[model samples]
Target: MARVRANPQFCSSKNEWKMKNNNERTAAVLGLGMMGATLAKLLLAAGYEVTVWNRNKDKSALLAEAGATVADSPGAAVNAGQVIVMCVHDYAAATSILSQTEQSGWKGKVLVQLTSGSPAEAEQQEQWAEALGARYLDGAIQAAPQQMGREDTPLFLSGKNAAWDQALPVLKVFAGSPEWLGIPAGLASSVDLATLSGIYGTMMGFFHGARIMEHAGFPVDKYAALLSGILGTFGEFIQLEGQLVHQNRFEKSESPMSISVDATARILRQAQESGIHDKFPRYVAGAFREAADKGLANEELAAMIKVLRG
Candidate 1:
């Protein structure tokens, strides 16, 4: 077992102590998939007595070899540890596993849910945990499994203030910075979804641009290099857009709505002529044109927020 290194207190507001004992530092990890297994290993390496449970018993074999106790069932795992970390496939799978465990086993245990889910689903799970007398915290791991245990790995967390304070020390063991978003049960999930939206939107733009380059017979490597240069300025543009949106001031901009609408129209035409799927370009063009039609042609491209908000 690894030695437990003491660290400075991260939470200022202390909650009622809920560990099994003052010195007991046992953690139960349910669902030994890539993320779950990584977490279990990190906990063990952090000197926690780790108990891991997986639907497929074989999945816990490696962790068992690493000195982790493999539990026969979710209930057994929950009973064995003061803290429970669940990283199942989704909200449904998490609920299914929880249903199998005896509700009485949940009382006094801290349940840290890292399962991917919507805000509504997260809220529902929080209510369920509360009804069962478990302290609940909804979390979203912002990094990949390989990035686990790194100091810069982000874990967005939201729950009752007391529950967060109780789990902060353990959470800090795996995540370099565990950000407390709010006391709302679903706030973490909401932030996770919003971040993913930006990622997907950027990916879609890259795909569309790559397709255009391919149609023009441009070398993909060269196109990718050019794309990287453009993307380097994206952070600045994003910051400006955010400021404009927050201040509700989108006029006198570098790129006006009329220019953006024209550029989008050209991209749509190029996509159509190249026999490429023009849906993406057309969608952008439609949005820009809609903003223009609303007399936002003189405003900055960020003025489209008005159309989107409507």
Candidate 2:
């Protein structure tokens, strides 16, 4: 359940409608980029009155056709709703429009910024919003725009209690899992970027490995069988990984058999001799050689994980 929040703008009987009206729930999304437009479509679909603002006049037209109200300017978009969602490309674009409201007051609105950026950027944007009197929340979109509105895609969130309290009810309208880290704005952003970095790093390693295998005459399509077989044992690998990592022991649990090294080194040396594969073996073998030279030769190839940690 979303925690009830008292918006600073809420006054006495004159502001009673802001507190009690169901139809009063509305959202404003600035920026009509892929992610921004996607989020606007989602809010509209979820039955919230949605308003949108985009610098490019034509950008908001599609959302407008999808039952969103397009505003001429950023301030107009924010004025149309109590909850404003900013999904610009980054901090600069979001701040460019939002900075327009600095001289004016923005006391009552809830601002949920979905711009993807560094932790420092999230923290800076939080302070920028506070200067305008708006409650700010930092949020991360863990999936592509096409995945928006899907259940459990993963969103990272953090900010003041008031901002989170007001936004949690709308999580059903966004993508996959929604994780609230803490009150500090950038905590979630840091996790999001770090997670993506790991994803890309693994992808590069997979691509490089697959390419090298193919260059050595092992076509990837044929190799996928072995790859699939290996992947099926991922849980076991992870278990062993945990044991190795925690115990600080990367010993001969899974020996690099002579057959395995002979086969791999045949490819490694062959690729190096042919100038087809570059220094991959340097990094791979360098760690193993370090272990092998250290008289840990009896330890399994998995022990290289320990050497690399060094």
lDDT per residue (tens digit) for residues 27-94 in model 2: 78888888888888787666676778888868876666566777777877777777888887777877
What tens-digit string does per-residue lDDT give for candidate 1 at 1-310?
A: 2212222231111111224345357789999999999999888777677788998987877787666778888899998888899999999899899998998998887899999999899889989988999899999998999998888998999999888987887899879888998778899999999999998988898899889888888888898888889886988988898899999998867778898889999999998887999999999899888888899999887888999899
lDDT of 1 at 194: 91
Best by lDDT: 1
Total backbone collisions, model 1: 0
True-vs-predicted CA distance for residue 173, candidate 1, Å: 2.1
Tell me the spans in candidate 2 whose CA falls farther than 4 Å from its real position. 1-24, 102-105, 222-271, 277-310
User: For candidate 1, which ten residues in a row score worst on lDDT?
Assistant: 7-16
Lowest-sum lDDT 10-residue window in model 2: 1-10
Score candidate 1 by TM-score against the native: 0.90
